[model samples]
Target: MTDPELPKLVLPGEYLGAAEQFLPGRGTYEDGGRIYASLLGVPAIDPADRTVRVEPRNAVPEVREGDLVYARVDELKTAMAVCTVLSTVASRRQVPGAPEGTVHISKAKDGYTESLAGEFAIGDVLVARVLQAHPGIKLTTAPASLGVVAARCQVCHALLTLGEKEAVCPRCGHREHRKFAKGPLPSPSGAHGPGGV
Candidate 1:
């Protein structure tokens, strides 16, 4: 007899095999006497269990309230900074769907924030805690461990190194004040600075 068919890529609604031969698993559905792919993925056949499943490619995790996240400042406003969440700290997976998050000036630091411009700048990457994920994602950097982890020099566009009260650019010697997080900061080599996160 000929060799059995190998698993192959499949699109939604593509027929997989007869339902009697293989039970439908994740990313698959059973219709009539046939199993079909329900998502864009590769069809996996389990000969032992006689099951068929479609493993989706690049499955990203969704954000949730209370999750720590890494985000880049997209826009700075008078009262808030609009940030696009890059990933969640726990899963390290790119946030799916609406990744836009907002951090009000009051939530930027623990004590108080005089102005949003004074505390944050566009393109700054920070660690934050998800305060709300309902109507829209709301973030807070009020904890000592949460705040600007990395930033670029506004004047020279070079990566800023962590300083006592702010970040300083080695290229331009430009010092910028930010609500820096407590503890260690991320370095250019992608490693944590002394005593930093």
Candidate 2:
């Protein structure tokens, strides 16, 4: 007679009901004839299939279509720029090691994204909408709520005010252009505690 035990897959943590595999990485498990997150990885859970969850290893952050994400500008153009996704705000420890994404100027604000400097610079962080995702995230700042989070003087790196028409550095009087938000946006550099939003 042979013994039958539970379908033990190689990974850790209890079954998160069900899970999905985004990429292949260390400490993963297979359950119900499928793979899922088994460690600190993308926030994926299946409701129907009860399986162990796991995570994959990569380099950059992954950006999905229609996801609100935080990103920093690596480079910019007259109409577009490349962005490195800083992290996922809505979910916990979202995908680890995805890839860098792109932010188009046409989508930089709600009204007219007439100029790139009107919203961002080489180092400004942005809260943006993911309009589409190719190899990289197609980003949008078209929402009134989405745009530059912090303003720095391009010349002197002084902190600037989130003004009605644009961001101005009080110390240097350097004016930065941007599509206006009603008031200042909540700080993006604020620290997030464990399981914090």
Instruction: Please list the residue runs of candidate 1 whose C-alpha ends up more than 4 Å from where it truly belongs after superposition.
Output: 1-51, 54-59, 184-197
114-186: candidate 2 lDDT, tens digit per residue: 7786567877777766766675678766656676776578878987788777787888888778654444333
- Candidate 1 local lDDT, 1-197, one digit each (tens): 11156356778899888988888889999889988889988777777787788888665577777777899999998889999999988777788764899999989987778998888889999888887878899988876677888899999899999776778799999989987777743332222235322
Shift in Å, residue 108, candidate 1: 0.5
Model 1 poorest 10 in a row by lDDT = 188-197
Clashes in model 1: which pairs? 184-196
Query: Estimated TM-score per prediction?
Result: 0.69, 0.58
lDDT of 1: 0.80
lDDT of every predicted structure (CA atoms): 0.80, 0.59
Q: Using lDDT as the measure, which candidate wins?
A: 1
